[model samples]
Every structure is written in C-alpha cells, then in structure tokens.
Target: MAAASGDNPSKLFAMPAIVADRRDDGSILIRSTTPLKASARCVGDWLEHWARQAPDRIFLGERASIETPWSTVSYRDARGIVRRAASWILAKGLSTERPLVILSDNGIDHALLALAAQHVGVPSAAISPAYSLMSKDFDKLKSMIALLDPGAIYVASTKPFAAALAAIAPLHRATIVSGNPDDADALSFRTIAATPESSEVATAFAAVTPETIAKFLFTSGSTGTPKAVINTQLMLTSSQQAKAQTWTFLEQAGEELIILDWLPWSHTFGANHNFNLVLRNGGTLYVDGGKPAPGLFATSLANLRSVVPTVYFNVPRGFDMLIAALRTDDELRRKFFEGTKFAFYAGAALPQNLWDALEELSLQTVGRRLPMVSAWGSTETSPLATDCHFLAKRSGNIGVPIPGTELKLVPSGDKLEVRVRGPNVTPGYWKAPDLTAAAFDDEGFYKIGDAVTFADPDRPELGLFFDGRVAEDFKLNSGTWVSVGTLRVAGIAALAPLAQDIVITGHGRDEVRFLVFPNLAACRALAGLADNADAREAIGHAAVRSAIGQGLARLKAQGGHSSGHATRALLLAEPASVDGGEITDKGYINQRAVLTRRAAAVAVLEDDGASEPIGCAG
Candidate 1:
C-alpha cells in the first residue's frame, strides 16, 4: 500500500514497501526516484539542477500579464534571470557567504534571486521591508540590515517600496528593476536578469550542496531581539521530501499547478510551507498582491475559481471570510474549491465551526470533502514540523513526525514539552549558541517550548494537539494549575460567536479572568452597521454589543476553568497591535507584553477601583 498518512503506525514497520533503509535517528528513509544526492541539496541547487534537467517547466515568476493563459516565470527562464542577476552582483565583488538582502514585498524576482543565491552559497535575507522603516525600532531594523551588511540590496521596482528603499538603503549597493520601477535606482530586477550569467550561475548553483546555508531568516519571539535561524539546503530539500506522502500535490499531470498566496513572506508557513512545496513539485505560484482578512479572499476566490490549484493554504481568518462570501455567493464557493486537491490552514487555531463550514462547502461541490491539513512547527524547525492528513475529520491535531523526523515529549515544568530531532531543525539560532544549547536537551532534540498532550501514537488518529505556550499557563490562588492553551481553546470555542480575541487573566490570585476582543464582524452584522460608518454604527453597535456583552459574560460564567470561573471584567475595544507588541507577527499574543501593556485591565480584575490600576479596564 502507498504511504498515505491514513496508515497505522504499528503496521508501518511491517510494510516494507513503504519503509526504506532505517537510520540511527529512528526515521526511515523512504524510497524515491528523486536523486539521493539531491535529497539534501539547497533550494538553489535543486532548482539549477531542475533547470538543466527540465528547462521548459515553469519557473519562479508571475504570468506575463493579467490575460496571459500562463502565469509567472517558468523554471528554465528563472535560472537564466537569476544567473544574470547573480553575475551582476558577483561582478560587484559580492561574496557567497555574506547574504544579499531582499527588502521588498513578495514577488516573482524576489523568489528567483533567493533560490538562485542559495545555489551559489550566498544566503538571501528577506526582511519585511515595510517593518524596517518608520517603526518603533529603526535601529532594530538597521541592525537586521547590518546583520548581513548585505553586499547587495534587491528592491522591487514598485513605488512605496522603491521610494522606501531609497530612504532605507542610502549609499548601500542598490539595483532597480523596470518591472515595478517607482524610482530610477541602479538597475531593473527583470532587466538585470536579462544580463548575461550563463556560465556564472550554472557554476555557482552546482557548488551549493547539503551544508550550504540556504537562508538566513529571522524570527521575532516574545523574549528578545529577533534571532536569526540558519537553514541548510538539505533542510529545505528534506522539508520538501517529508511532504511527499501527505499530498498528491506533486502528482499533477502536465498543466502547471497554480497557487495564489497572500501570506507574509517572512513567516515559515507563508514562505517555505506553501512556496517551497509549489517549487519542489514544479508548480506555479501567484503572489496575491493583496493582504488578508478581506483583500486576499476575494482575489484568492477569483484565482482559485478558475485555475484550480493542486493545493490551497489559508489562515483561519481567511477561511472565515471565504465562508461568509461562500454562504452568500454559491458560484464563488463552487469556483473557489473547484479543481482543488487539498487545503491547509495555519498561523492560528481554526474553530470547529469554521472547519465545518469549509467541509460543508467542499462536500457540496465535490461530493466528498477534501482534506484540509494543519501543520505545526517553529522557525527553528525550518517551519513545518508536523502536518495532519485529511483522511478523517479535521481534528486540528498536528500529525505524525515526517519521514526524517523523530519526536519525544520531555516532562518539563508542569507539562510535557514536545521535542523533535531532524535534519529540518536549524543549526541553532544564528550566533546564539548558548540560547540554542538551552533550547534542546542532553539528547539533542530541540525542545519545542510549547506544552503538548500525547494522543494516539500508533494509529495516531489526531496525531498531537498543541497545548499553550510553556509560559502562558499558570495556577490560581488555590494552586490548581490552569493551561492557558486549553483554557483559550475552550474559551474561544465557547465564545466563538462573540470572540475575536481573548486574554485570560488572574495569574497569581483567585479564579482566571480575561480581557476579550469581540467579534466585530459579528457585531457589525448584528448591529446593521456599515464598514465606514464608525460614528453612526458605534451608537447602534454599543447597544447591540452591550446585549451581546451580557451574553458573553454569561457564556464565560458558564465555561469556567477547572472550577466555576468568572471573568472579573472584560473591556472590548481596540484590536491588538503587532507594532505595539500586543501580538507577534504570527498573531500569537505576547502574554507578558499584554499583561504589562494592559496593567489596568489586570488590576480591574484583581480589585476594581482601589487597586493600583484604577483606570485599567477600558
């Protein structure tokens, strides 16, 4: 039998057809015609080889224009372009080790150079160009820019970005592309690709092998400055290999597999999770030029409606918005999931209701619901660690360890911390050896930090569920420990209708309290308020929300934690902000940051007017 994730784990060893040569690391090297040497090659190396092998296949780029039947740059052409650009950069004495920085939004040229750079051993660092300028930390961004001292900077030929880069990278090695040219900088991204590098890029890509540093990506965590994560070509290659059994994604016959993605390029899910999958399997990706929650779904529905992607990946909010559109517009729903093979949701926990809605839509169109997978991983794990298959109900569990991975649950403070050891795991945070050492155990498995409860391991139905962050859970005054992850999931599920976001309170004292973010969408609908009518809608929304507020209060009253819990006070206004440190880029709340920022809310929960936080609850 094929190694679909639906197989029983106990029977896996007996099935020799699926299992391959066993490794010392408790992982089986499954059989594949994909070159064994190419197994761990960096992305650039992989692509360069593919370019030579299958030059005609589509490569890294958007389609010619809106009306073109074919979209994006094909692989063969992508190599040629990268080679030209690589020659331009290299001619300027660009070193392979000191990365080239991409300070722009997601686009075709952005992807091409990133992969191409990896082929030649020069790691590419793509930071959120938007996040760099005019923020609370200009130096913080400058420090990131300084991290690589980027020998060269590649800017999208577009406006604000082109204008922004001019201000951001003054006196730095700069080049411009005519494709999105807003400013007259040094060179064009596409025009430079037209520059000749026939011998240069081909020579570079062949040398970048398993150990070559593919990417030098950074992740901003709750604790400190954004630490860099070093990824090897092997890690990127293995990541692609691991997904072979989970998706028939690579099984498309001849037509290019199309993908329209709006997820941020910095995040693992947005970058490697979707992009790498499409790249490895020889698929075409359409960079959704719009942002999400609203901008993306409409474009995505339009793109997927006709093109029919081999796979689709969206966040929970994206799915929610799509459901709303689908419920009202059947044609959109039918077209949205039309030729879709499988779907994936990441970044946040998807409620059962949202998953149910997606399933209903899929079942209506295709007669059988397509599998919508949820993957779990950290930046340290090169992003995707575990992915659940869609054979059964959407359990929201992050499925089994992929082919080259080994998992363990180490009992830590008050919970068992999930750990994994695999090639996919980074070589540790860049320049943070001590931090990396502490991140793992004596056994060398990287400690995942979050607490997780072990589920079925053999048949492993819902592979494993994510508990809250190791730091989020706390105990009551009575000393009964409460898991923030569990409480949040339960609380959100209970208050799904009225919930947008909820911050559980009362850490040291009595029962747990919360600062909730209301479902403004639901509020708007219930209050009959239009989007732009903030003033007029607020008057009506206040009354409608107040009534719904009482319902939420009652809902929280019933859904207590461990015991009969009550939310001492919940003030609903203002969405959480990433810039303000209320949340991470991944949308995971910084509990400590929230606690410090909303000191008054916590104070109100403890002792209302007389406490240190008199004006806390807003």
Candidate 2:
C-alpha cells in the first residue's frame, strides 16, 4: 500500500487485531478482539450529551434553496426545540402502537421532529419521499401506512404530497402535520416546535430504555413489499459505539467533525450510520438537499464547493458522479481533499475504475491518495456489522467484524453465507411475527442472506470481501454458479463509462448475459452527438454500438468461465423504475425485480437471432 503524503498513518486509522476462529464443520467466526465500551442508553442520550458539551456548536445546517444561505441550529437550541416538540408529540397520543411517520426529505425540521419523537419514546418512520412523490399509484406508501398505523404523519410541504396523502386518507385516521404553516388542513410544524415544554416531556424521556424502538426504517423491497426493519436504541447506540472504537481518530484528532451528506434519512446508511455518527461525536451535519441523480448531482457539487467536510460519506453511484465533477474542476477537487480524513462508500460494490479515478484525482490535487473504505451490513443490523479501519488494498474489501458483532460464515455451496449476531442487530421485522421468527437461525443469528470470503485466507486479520447475495447467485444448465454482485461490478468496470448498471440474466440457461442500462452522456460523447440529442438516436449510433461491442469483447478476454463472462449484452433505453421495485431510492438495482419486470428484454438476449444485442467476440 502507498503511504498518504503528509498524513500520519497512526492517526488515520485504527489497526484492530482481528481474531478468526475456524470450526471443524468448515465454518468460521470472525470479530475484532477489541471489546466494545459501554454505550448510551438511547439516542436521546447522545443529544443530551452534545447539548451540554457543545452548547453553542452548530449541530445541523441546511438551505432552503440553492441561492439561499445555510440555516443552522445549535446543539443547545436543538435540545430546547426537541423538548417542546416532544411535549406536543406526547400530547398527541403518539406511542409504540401509533408511531410517528415522516413523508419528507432531510431537513432541519425533519431532523427536529424525528429527534423529538424518539426522545419521547415515540418511534418515527421516515419513509422514502420517492414513494410518495414519484409513484403514480402510491401502492407502497398505502401498504406502509397500513402496517405502521401511525398516530400522525408529517410532511415538509403539502403540495407535493397532496395526492399521496389523499390516496391513504381512507386507510387511517392519523393527524397530518405539515412544515408549511399555510396548509390549512394540517397542524403546523412551527407551532409544534414552539409548544410549551410540559412535565410529561421529561417523564416520557426518562422512561426510554435501550430496547426502545428509535425508528422504523423500511427495506428496499427488492424481492417483495418493503419490510419495516425495527431499529432499537440499543441497536443504534451500540453500532455507533462500535464505530467510535474502530475509528479512534474521530476522538483522537480533536477537530470538530464536519460532513456534507445527501443520503436520505430513510435508509440505514444515512440514518443510523452517518446521521447518528455525527450526533454521537458532536459533529456538524449539513443536510444536503441534493441526490446522486442527473439534475440533483449538480446541487451536490455546489454544496461540496462550499463545505469542505472532515469526512465524506456516499454510495458508489454518488462517488461515481462526484469523481466526474472532481476530475475537471480543480477548485472542487482541492477543496474536497483538503481537511478530509477519508472517503467512504456503501450501498453497492464500487467498480474498480471508479476507485482508480478517485485515487488518481486525490493524488493529483492533494499529493496523496485519500483512504477509500467501506463496511457491509443491512438495515436489520443497524448497518454497521464490519468496519474497514485500515486502508484496504482493493476496492471491495468490507474489512472485519466490528467489536460487539460476530460473523458466522457458514458454507452455502460455492459461497460462505454470513450471519450476524450482536446487540446492534435488529430483533426482527416490525408487526410481522412470521418474518421476525423466520429471519433468525436456531442459534439466534440474523440470517443476512449475503456471502463473503477472506481477503487473505491464511491471514484472517486482513478482513473479508463482499461476495454477491446468496439468493442472487444462479446455476447454469451445466450446473455452474454465477455470482451476480461480483459479475455486475466487474462488468461495469469492464464497460467503463458506458454501462451505468447491468442486470445479469440466464438463471437456468447455458450462459450468462447482461441487460445493461447505458450511460446516456457517455454514449452521446462516444457517438459524437449533440448534448441534447435524442436518447434513442444517441444509443443506436453505429459508433456507440461498436464501442459497446469492443467493451464486451475486452471483458470476455479476461476469462474465467462461462458463468463469469457475459456472452451477450443488450443496451436498455428506459431507466430502472422505483415503483416497479427495479431500483431503490438509494440507487441500488434489484436484479430479480429487473429480470421479472422486463421478461421481454430477457427473452431478446436469450434469442440467438436478436440483432439488438452486442455479441462478445471469441
């Protein structure tokens, strides 16, 4: 590994001694030898600690628009506001049975309302805004509302959610609360924030325990309807505690941590991992209103120019977008690397090309490459099962199990299926007793359904790499297995700048194939088309098809087997649909959903006579 210029290696990472225990049955258990320290009782404890320790420090910052200045709230002020809001929530009869549900993006108001609800033992469910705003039918939102049976529903504005609210109006009698004071049909957020702090607020807060449900975060629903993953105070607090232990620099560095993040609070990566980490460490969180989409990424770049974060957190897609901006914009690159400890990615396995680009840019601008690291876990684990405390030699290393967690690697055919058990792990899915019971093994470990392998089999301390999902792997007619997650990442890297995301096909067929979602910008550039050229015109150009054919051929040359290399690929014009369960709000592609939804497209690839596919050369 190359040393980071002008950076002390000792201060940059915590090199914990990982211990792996090999079982006689070909299974393995791994964990960091470092013990987890005592954690806070609940999420409110962290807020209280920060409120007292850094009373005047800016806890949260956000903007109303691109042109507007940031509006910040101090820790002390946040506590006061939370207390008053908690009193109002308590008076509203919101409890475990009738939790608080939020239907808005990340903002100061949204944060305050969630904190208030959690502070008073009222679990808050932050549903993805896309479910309400993007979906025409609102079927997912209605189902979530029915499951939650919330006492109240909150939205930042009423206009965008008017249709969704009306869609679920017949399902529940929950009170509606809007951030916009002008919404006459709902109670105002501003009024609730200013509600008188009653004695009941303190009583309710004192009653909160470690096992108390802090929030309900829904899964991406890749296979079926999204399940409500119960996040307890213990799960949240212990996860952060394990993190602080792994990344000792957060406290050792003595600098106030600052982050500019756009990941939605609805997802565990953003909520329990990033958001809670900031609060636990008394850091300032700039709630970016941007996303990693086409028009929205420009806003993220704008925010990055203004705020040089101490640490940056994003998914592979977000980093991919940011890398493009950073390569050309010298000013943005310099600012982004300056005062930055490292860059973290999750949500999907990052393509090696993207990782190489980021390192190259960091070296060019900062004279040293920043540590690009990742962790592996799901919403049910409070999202922090493993931590890459040391710099990984490759792109996909998810490191070792964090201090309180135990990873049981049981052999499942060609892969090791990883199961997790710890205080950080969720008990089960909310309101579904069957799912709760079926989620665990006989020994009480949460069956995460993901597979992993040792980075260095002989040297257990080197950590592990994320293998594809167990359910995603399929057998060909020759009885060979194809790892979808591994192949997808490799394919994206091999196709570089052309394939944005690829879905593997041929579950029981003789060979693997790809349903690629082409990157329109790159295709247009390759085809020598105008920036505003029609999507079909650009993608169908001879030059674009030739380039794709060459990429596919190149991928085939780096041979493994028929299951490893995709024999043919078809470029998709229509993007993955959020309502169809083809994609998640965080930009992760659901392979099964995509294949099931686009059966005709799959049939096209399976047909030898289909001329649309770019065939791989022998």
Candidate 3:
C-alpha cells in the first residue's frame, strides 16, 4: 500500500504517492494504504518459477578459487541446496522460528542458508562476517547474537571466526555450526551442499505464507541497543517485485550483474537487500572479500581484476581507492570497466569529488558516462525504498519510492520528516511493542526520522535529498539550530583534499569546532613532510594552514561567519581510539569516553591547553 500516490500534481506526480495531513509550513502528511491481500511469494523461494522456465541458467555463484568460474546452480540445484541445508539445520536441532545463523564472508553459502531458512519458514539472522574476523568492534557481535536467539550460528572453518564465535557462544541460545568441512564440531557447508538436485524444495517449502517471518535483520545500532526488525516472506517478495519493476522501467533487460562488496553481511545493504535484488533476476555474483587498502584484500582484488562486473556496488571510501587504481593501472582499468554497466554506492555519504571522479572515469572507459547512483533505506524498511536513479534526472536526490511504497513528509518544527508504509516496510521492532507503537503515526505510516526537501520542485517524480537526522540536529546556545549530520557530511567533503574526516562540536556550545584528521597519504605527499622531526613540523605547518583555509571557507559557505558552522579552532593530531583512547567501532566519538581518557585533549578543546582541533569520527 502506497502512502504517497502520483495522482496529485502538486504533491506527487506520475510516480510514487504521498498522503499526509497537509500543514501550513510546506509539509504534507503521508498516510498508509488500507490492507490488500497480495501474493505471499517471496524472492528467497526462487525455485518454483526458475525451475520451470530456466533450469539451466546460473542462479548462484561459485567461489573464484574454485575450478568453475560460476556454477549453474539451476532452479533444481537451488531447491536441493535449500532442502539439504534445511534438513541439515533441522537435524542440528534448529526449529522453524529458531533458525541457523551465518557469519561468513559473502558467498553462495549465504544464498543456500537464506533460502533454507525461507523454506522452513524460519528467519536466519545473517550476522556480519567483519565482526567475527575484523576486530574493529567486537562487543556488538555478541549482543546481536543474544538478541536473535538463533538455534545455530554458522561460520567459515578456515577463518578465525570459530574462536570469535566461541568467545560469544556463552551468550547465544543456539549451537555453533562451523562452515569449514574439517571442523569436528561443525557441519560441512560443502558436504551439505552436495545434496542431489530435486524439485521437492519448492513443494516442500510451499507451506510458508505471507505471515511467516523471513528475516530478522539487526540495525546498525549506531546510538543504542541493536534492534531486531521483523521481515516477512511477503515483505521480501514485494521488495523484489518493486526492484525488478523499477529496473525494467529503465528499459534494460535482465543483466549479468556481478557485485563485489565488503560492507559486512550484518548490514542489510550487503546482506538482505542487495543480494535479494540480484537474485530476483538470475544474475552472477562474484563474492569479493577485498579491502581497498593494501594486504590480503589487495590480493583478493588482484584475483578479481580479471572479472569485469556488469554491476558494481561499493562504499564511498572503496570507490575512491578503486577509481585511483583504475586511473593508474591499465590492466585493472580495462578489466574493471569493460563490462561495467552501472554503479551504485551506499554505506556512507558519497563525496562530491568522488562523485565527480567516478563520472569522468565512467565516461572515459564506457565512451558514455554511466550513472553513479544510490538508494536510501534501512533494515526497518526491509532495506528497499528510494533508489537514486540518474537515468531520468541527474541531481543529487535519492530516487523515488519503489512501485508499492508510500512516502509522506510529516511536518515538524522547521523540518519535514519522512514516513512510509508498504509491504516492503517491516511491521515493527522485535519484542518492542512500545517502540513499534511509537514508530508509526495514527494512519500507520512508518516514520523515517530523516529530514528531506523537494530540491527539484518542477518534477515531483524525483524524490528528495537527505537534510539531516531529526535527533542529530540541535540548537546552539545562541538559539541557532545546528544540523550535525549535514554539517559532518559537508565537513568531510570540504576537507577531502586534506583531512580524511571531522567531528563537529555543537552541544551546548556557541559555535561548532572540529577535531580534524589529516589525510596520511596527502600529508606524506606534501613537500618536506616525513616522519622525521623537521618533516613532522613541515607537515603540521602545512596542515594548520590547509585546515585554517578550509575552516574559513566552511564558515563563509554556511552564510555569515556568525553561523554555527564556523570553526573556532583545529587540532593537528588524530583522535585517540580504544588503544589510544578516543573512538569506538560504531565510528562513535564517545565525548565523555574521550574526555576521560585524554584530559589533555579535553583541556585543549576547552582552550586550557592549546587552541587545537582534535580529529574525531562524527
């Protein structure tokens, strides 16, 4: 049910609809549509149709190191994998609701485990592989499992996940299932995958209905406890339909898309949503666990350099590194962009410079500039909502809602908040009815607490751009409101040439200052700047000058120098972390945590030490 419709030419045109109680302050109320019974068919149960129409086509992927470039895990094979995986999971003491959990690098095993969960009408919580291997943040991993109450947790045997999983096992309601074939305590994902092909997977799993729980994706939990959002079978199915419908509107047939992502499986971007969109139409997926920085991830990139994907999805940081590589390396550039058709970015804000660079490179390689677009959604919305399609228009706005989605702008004090309701949208937060009740308006429109504006007034079909998070915006002591989200994003872009990022200070303060982090690479490139004493002095000098210029420019851009955005000072040093005593895994700069850890830094911010801007992750 769409909350916003294309009928009203003033509010919404021939696109997605929005129905909200109109307010005087340039705002419209978006209300949810009445219930309608639609097909319960879900994307995870992909076997029924694919088995009949194109049983020979490749539906899932085989790893790069394997002998086959990709396996034709036909409709039949997919079903068999599901059946075997379901059987194996059930045999390992898993129940319908209490399902098998996977925390592995993205691969076919995910598809198998996912479908098996769908078949049995169970919701497999796909935990992030990064949490298990990459030690950026560890405590969150244990908390996520405790919330899910999974019957079994699965991990790759070769990886160090077993040890990590073991550390967190005491908190889990499930048994541990190792992905490795050699592990004595684990069920071999490979051996279970060897089950003979069968059509029974469809028929056997047909009992799943619209009400059946499809997935329980955990929110990124940046500021609070990790929330388990319920995803139903119909929710996923409708999202796929909406995605396929949106793709078809662009006049493109089914594409042989290949995506390489390491954004982590725990997030809906890499797990529940992106993968579902790919499988909706039978396409190839190259599971790349590569990192943009040098080391093992580099080796993975070297291996993937040969397969030029038709569809590429990467984060803003990763795109910067990839573009630099494409510009410098001829072989990589050719292989990477040769077959590349479209690119999508997410996980963070895409900087204007990076966006400009990508447009230029795409033009050079493809002879016609390819669209660099993205989408906006969360696990709360089943991770499918507004997609930024540059095909119709190329402004920076995130695209309109999928066919079934309804979005409205609920008027707030000097801000318009977003709200949506549709099959793709999740019902509510798990075991938090109070949260669920508070989450939606009277008309049942699920509130998305982000600020938005209609930048393109001429075309209502084009959706709005993000203004800021409602809570993240606050009033300075001077009574001037500060949008921290917008400010942080702009600060990162403004200092792109020098600083990596900045954390804005505006909590009960008269003006906002930044803790800036200088770009290590750029600092190295500055003349006379090295790790030596004289070099360090040179680096600090150049950095202070560059930072001062940026700060002044930032002040001017925000209007007058009196605006909250005007920088008061800058710290030449990077923020301390867990080891150094500053930042956390969520990229959260614990103000109190940092202040307690480094009284000197707090004193500096307070101007008791020096007028230095401490670098911080916003």
Candidate 4:
C-alpha cells in the first residue's frame, strides 16, 4: 500500500503499491507488483540489443572541459570496439586466476575494457584509484595486488601510477596496459582497440552463464581491509530487472533516458547501479568528471549548466554541494530541475535539511516539487534490493523491495536485522570461503548486517528507515542503546550545512557527545572568510562555533532521551584519513573507522575540562 495517492499534482511522483507477506516471526517480506524477469542474461546482451536496434545512438559521452566538445560513443561503435578488445584479451589467455585489473578513474576506455572482459568469461576487478594515487605507504594497494595476482592491469596514464605499478610489478606477472605512453612495458590501449575481431569472441560471449563471475568489486573496507565480492551475471541482471519493474520511467522514456554520473566505477553504486542501469534501459550516460569534493564540484556545476539530465542520482554529499549551487544560480537551477523527474541518493542517509531544501528549490523553479528518492542495498546485493520510487513526505524513506527479492527482517537486540535472499544477491566472496559461509543464514539468505525500522508499524508498505549497523550501535552507561545511523542524520540536519558528518561518541559513557567534522567550505562561507582559509582557522571562527552551538541546543531541545542528544561536542580540523578506512571513495563516512581512528579525540569529548565544548541546552 502506498502512503498517499490522489489528484495532487505534486504527488505525480507518488510511491507504488507495496505487496507484503508477513510471517509470524516478526519477519516481513515486501515487494512490488511488477514482476522481475531478465530480458537479457548477461550485460553484454543489452549492449548487443541497442547496437542492433539503435546502432547510431550515443551510448556514452565525456568531455575534458566546458569548452571542449563531448567525445561520444555509439552503441554500434562500442560493440565493434568491445569485440576487438575481447580478441586481444583472448590472445593473452585470461582466466579466473589471472583476471583483468583496472586502476583508473572512469572513462570510455575503462568502460570498454570492463565490458570486453565481462563479454567473455574473464572477471574484471576495478580497484579504487585512491589506493594508488592517495595512499602514502601503498600498503592497501600491495595487499590487493597480492590477493588478485591479476593477469593484466589497465590504467589511463602510466605517469600517475608508475610508482604504484613498480611497487607491485614484481608481485604478479600481469601484462600492463595504459592509455598514455609514459610506461615502456605497458601495451597501448589504442593497439588493443585496433585488434581484429575473431570468431572465438562470439563463442565466448554466448557461453557466459548465469553463474559466471562477471566482476570482482571490493568492499569499502570501512571497518578493515576490503574483501572482494563476486558479482555473477545473475546477480547483476536480476537486480536490473527489479529496477526496470519499479522505475518504469526508464522504460517509458526509452532511449531518451539521460544521466550524468561521477561516482567511481570501482564501487557498485556507480559500476552496477548507475552504469548497468543505463545499459539495461538502453540510455545514454555522461561520464561526469566532477565529484562531491569542493574543488572538483566546480566541474559538476559547469557540466550541469551545459546538459540537463532526465533522472539525477548522487550521494547526499554531492547534493549538499549541489544545493548551494541551486540556491544562488537561477540558470543552473532551471536547467537542473526542468527535465529532472526524480533525485536519488545512496551510500548514506540524507539529512532532512537537504531533503527540504531540494523540495523547496523544485517548487520554486518548476512550480511543482519533484520526488527525491533513495534505496537501500550493499555491494553484495547488486546494490539494489529496495528502491523508493514514490514521493516520500520526508527523508530516510527506503521503500519496499523490488520484485523477485525477499527481505527477511530477523529480530536482533531491540532491532530488526535485514536479510536478503534472491538471485540478485551475491553468492559469496572471492577466495574467502569461510567469510562467505559466515555471511549467510541457515535458510541461505545473505546476512547484510544492517538493521531497519518501519516508518509506520501498522503499514508495512509505507517503507523503512535505516537503523545503524548492529555492530556499530552501542549501549551507554545507563544501558540505553544509541542508534548511530539515526542520530547521525538528525545531528547533520540540526547542524545544517555546518557539520558535514558527526562521529557519535560516549559509547558506554554517561551521555552522548560528538566529534564534529565541519564542512569547511560551508563553514567558510558562513564565517565570511577568505576562500583559501586553513581548516583550523576556518573552524575556529566565532560564527562557525556559534552556529554549531545553536545546533546542539536545538538537538537537546528536541531530544527524546539521553542517547538522542549530544551533551558535549568538539570540532575537529583534521579530515578523515582514507588509508585508515575513515572515508570511502563515494563520500560515505565510516562511523566505526572514525571512532577507532579518533579514539583520543572521543576521549577528550567525554572530559569537559579537556577541551572547550559546545554546550547543549538542558
């Protein structure tokens, strides 16, 4: 059952009716009316479909700058290139043990290479470029190299990753492929693209089965070193069918569906969800070079000015940056909201302030508010188990499951642990049999480790809000449990744009405190400081401290109990360490990683005399 449905124009983006099957064990199964059935078994099937049906259509696009023209790829052209690349791949004799490894940002080359590998039986692993470019010790990169022992490694340029490549060169016997010419040993990407197609390429593509492992995407390593999650053709294709059923707008739009995405292909959100969704629906994707980070967001803003997409999707942080642009730039706002039907966010729970701000912007620009949607899933679930297709009244509404997937809510300690069983879910982790065995329940459902609570207990179809991970939540000194995920969203909303993310402290302590990571750009803007102000100087400003203090008072004023409010807080200037697993490439903060890395800072928050605190109202 949908929350509301009537003649209201603003409710044009209303939710679909939910079909539920409730069990006696407090476990519930929710799904959509639209059945899930794959039109194509493998991803390559869709590529071939569009190539034959709409050969001249643009499948993917990218640009170097605002002034530059987009370099486009047609479906027909992509198929030819993929076949040629596959022939070259077959020449090298790639197998499961010696797979293809890509270490670079997203591009046409990256997309074609991934498609080529999956078109055959070889599994392609897109390792995060951050590990190679950002890390100082390269310990994580070395570990990954040891685990994969790739048969081939591809990078956009040899110059940027030369040191990282050299460090791991002796570890594995991988053939190097690079787009740029700096590396002497690496094969040229252009040369591979020029390889003639072979008859064996068609046989290899046709032989791919549902059980064939198509990709190996590593987890975010939020709590520890990343584990390689095996994504099969069944997992990826079934998930897309579920999506096509729920989000009918994609099918309705036909080949007209357009998207601009910057999320990394290394992660499932970009690779499986966004990228695969476009291919499945026969749409065009503009590979956005801009990211949510302040410096890089300018590129995103520039891109938006030029191209307005039909369906927009990003993480909450990206919206945070985009909202600021929407508020002041009328031309950008008009272009963004005019053709956009829905805005989707994942990778984190969105703050309510950003939610409200987007609705208001839509109403102001379009004379009607558009739907802001989101879903809940993980890298293992093909990243789409539940999707919110309807117009939710507020934020944090992860609607019922898409068709073909069953959600089993098992009772945990005062929380419901969400488990999933379906073809869309991954079978296991790569090479980690024990970990894979431990990840499932007795009935074979994957134990996702997340907790959920219904929006309305009497109405199962209304949707569910994500509770904190069962392991991340902790009991206070008073034995009251603190839901870190719930409270984090509330705190971010209370602090508005000032606090980008808050690490809830006071675990097993008398009360909850916060180690606040200030959104330096927003804080600087609020403080009327120079653009180049250092983090320390920016966060120490009188205006910034006052805004945070006010936000704390507001949280305390609306508190339900001790765990619901932060009694003390401290602003931190040091950003989250990527190597320490405190932040993912997708801009999601790992609460557990932050707590572990900033243990001393949290300790100081518990002691009033140790640091100057932002006091809460009693």
lDDT of 3 by residue, 426-445 (tens): 88887789988998988888
Rank by TM-score (best first): 2, 4, 1, 3
- TM match of model 4 to true structure: 0.96
TM-score, one value per model: 0.85, 0.98, 0.83, 0.96
Q: Which ten residues in a row have the lowest lDDT in candidate 3?
A: 1-10
Give each model's whole-structure lDDT: 0.63, 0.90, 0.61, 0.86
Could you tell me which 10 consecutive residues in candidate 4 have the lowest summed lDDT? Answer: 1-10
Screening candidate 4 with a backbone cut-off below 3 angstroms (N, C-alpha, C), the clashing residue pairs are 1-18, 15-390
- Model 1 lDDT per residue over 552-596, tens place: 455456654542344443645666655555765445566677777
lDDT of 2 by residue, 224-322 (tens): 689999999999999999998888877743226898999999999999999998999889999888888877888888888888898899988888888
Better of 1 and 2 by lDDT: 2
After superposing candidate 3, which stretches have Cα over 4 Å from the reference?
1-27, 30-40, 62-76, 134-138, 194-204, 249-252, 293-304, 334-338, 364-367, 392-395, 527-561, 568-603, 606-611, 614-618
384 Cα displacement, candidate 3 (Å): 1.8
lDDT of 2: 0.90
Better of 1 and 3 by TM-score: 1
User: Model 4 off-target regions past 4 Å?
Assistant: 1-19, 22-24, 32-34, 181-185
Once model 3 is optimally superposed onto the true structure by TM-score, how far is the C-alpha of residue 373 displaced, in angstroms?
2.0
Model 4, residue 501: distance off in Å is 0.8
For candidate 4, what is the lDDT?
0.86
Pitting candidate 1 against candidate 4, the one with the higher TM-score is: 4
